[model samples]
Target: MTGPGLRREVRAGWSLFRRDMLKFRRERARIVSSLLQPIMFLGIFGLGLKNVLGGTGPFQELDYIQYIFPGVIGINVLGISMSTGVTIVADREFGFLREVLVAPISRLTIALGKVASGVATAMFQVAILLLLSPLLGLTPGFVQIVLLMSAVALLAIATSALGVLMASRIRSVESFQYVFQFMLFPLFFLSGAFFVLDRVPPWIAFIANLNPLTYAIDLFRHILYGDIELGELSRSLLLVNSPAEDILIIAVISVVLLSASVVSFVRME
Candidate 1:
């Protein structure tokens, strides 16, 4: 593309991004609910499970709340990022999407802009969670926070793309929500977010291995638990892959999903 064409595309992408952000800002209920849902999960599940799982087996030395903190954040990121796609379905229904579609810029720019907005919103919620981390007795330093944010950002890229891909095809908001939740819950449960993957049955493990969120959560634990020493069993169960491997896997998924979503948007009616 020539300089002027590139500039026009950049401006178009930014405009789409800005529009989503404006919507995000005006939705007061969305901001409140997004933060509340995860806190409820962390508090209710963390406290409840602590009694049952704490001071037992691999969790004997680990703080159960601390162990699942990153997992909770992963859930939040995954959920919010994917929900961003719902806006597209709504846009189509309300006729706003047609305006953007008529623009001369490539469809890829529009898809990416939407994804970028979702990533931004997810990260914003994550910042709030990280601030509340110390309340749960988890204190990550500056560098640790940066590393965690970087990983979460990458995870958001793939998830948001997946959402956009689905939204591109689904015509109704109701249907998109139904289909998204159907997939989202399974991804979270199979991600080892609440339990160790290694101890699960072979069938579950095999399915979890294919889930992108599984590697994402495992990557979170790998970073958050980097300095903490763990027993052989705990280490094996928690850290599914090395940092390098986790990043590579998530990166590959992000590329594939992003490419597919762009194609979906290009073909979208």
Candidate 2:
């Protein structure tokens, strides 16, 4: 039998989930902007850089736009998913979180519900971008498409957890915006989002390897093109030494971050 606390937590999660959905329903402009930004990046940067980087070896024999679509998609998912934390902070400032906290629900449930809502919204954004990927020349078979979606879903969940953790630690929206800008730009730039990692300097490559975003980008690249050497991909980017090892690392990281965020939220006053 579940304890009173556990039941309250579950009920609170449902309530928070409904509230988040309603908030999104009211913010139609933000929703449209999130969906449009990725598409614009794909059309402008992806295709615009295609010609100049066309002869580059890593991207050789493939259209540059097609080669980079997976990475771009991954970046978009990361940004949108991570940005959900802003909403949490906004709620706290606006007294919505305070009202919710007065209820019997466990803090962990509130955190989980926020992350789940963010992940759901991110998945929807990804779906919209994916539908337009064909215009950018990404045509995958049924199984490949499923694999791609799975990879993005995993990425979304991980980033959402990270976002929740960040939100829990910050008290003000202004502070969060500054911190997020600093955190995300470096993470995105260090990642192989716009260029091949191997071609980057040794120091930069080392840092990129340490960045979780690199592993995510590599995983998505494999799913998209299957051009990269699985052995090199596994070792250099993921530091896992094998495909199974890489998957294990990603699974562990995602689970740990998610759990940490939930626990932190539970402990929050």
lDDT of each: 0.89, 0.75
* Alpha-carbon lDDT of model 2: 0.75
Model 1, span 1-269: residue lDDT tens: 88999999999999999998898999999999999988998888899999999998778767888878888999999899999899999999999998989879899899999999889998999999999877876678888889999999999999999999999989999999999989988888898888877768889988888888888888888877766779998788668788898889999999999999999989987
TM-scores, all candidates, are 0.97, 0.87
Which regions of candidate 1 are displaced past 4 Å? none
State residue 249's C-alpha deviation in candidate 1, in Å. 0.5
Query: How many residue pairs clash in each candidate at the backbone level?
Result: 0, 0
lDDT of 1 at 194: 88
Q: Could you tell me how far off, in angstroms, the CA of residue 38 lies in candidate 2 after the best superposition? A: 1.5
What's the true lDDT of residue 71 in model 2? 68
Give the least accurate 10-residue stretch of model 2, judged by summed lDDT: 232-241
For model 1, give the 10-residue run with minimal summed lDDT: 220-229
Runs off by more than 4 Å, candidate 2: 1-8, 226-243
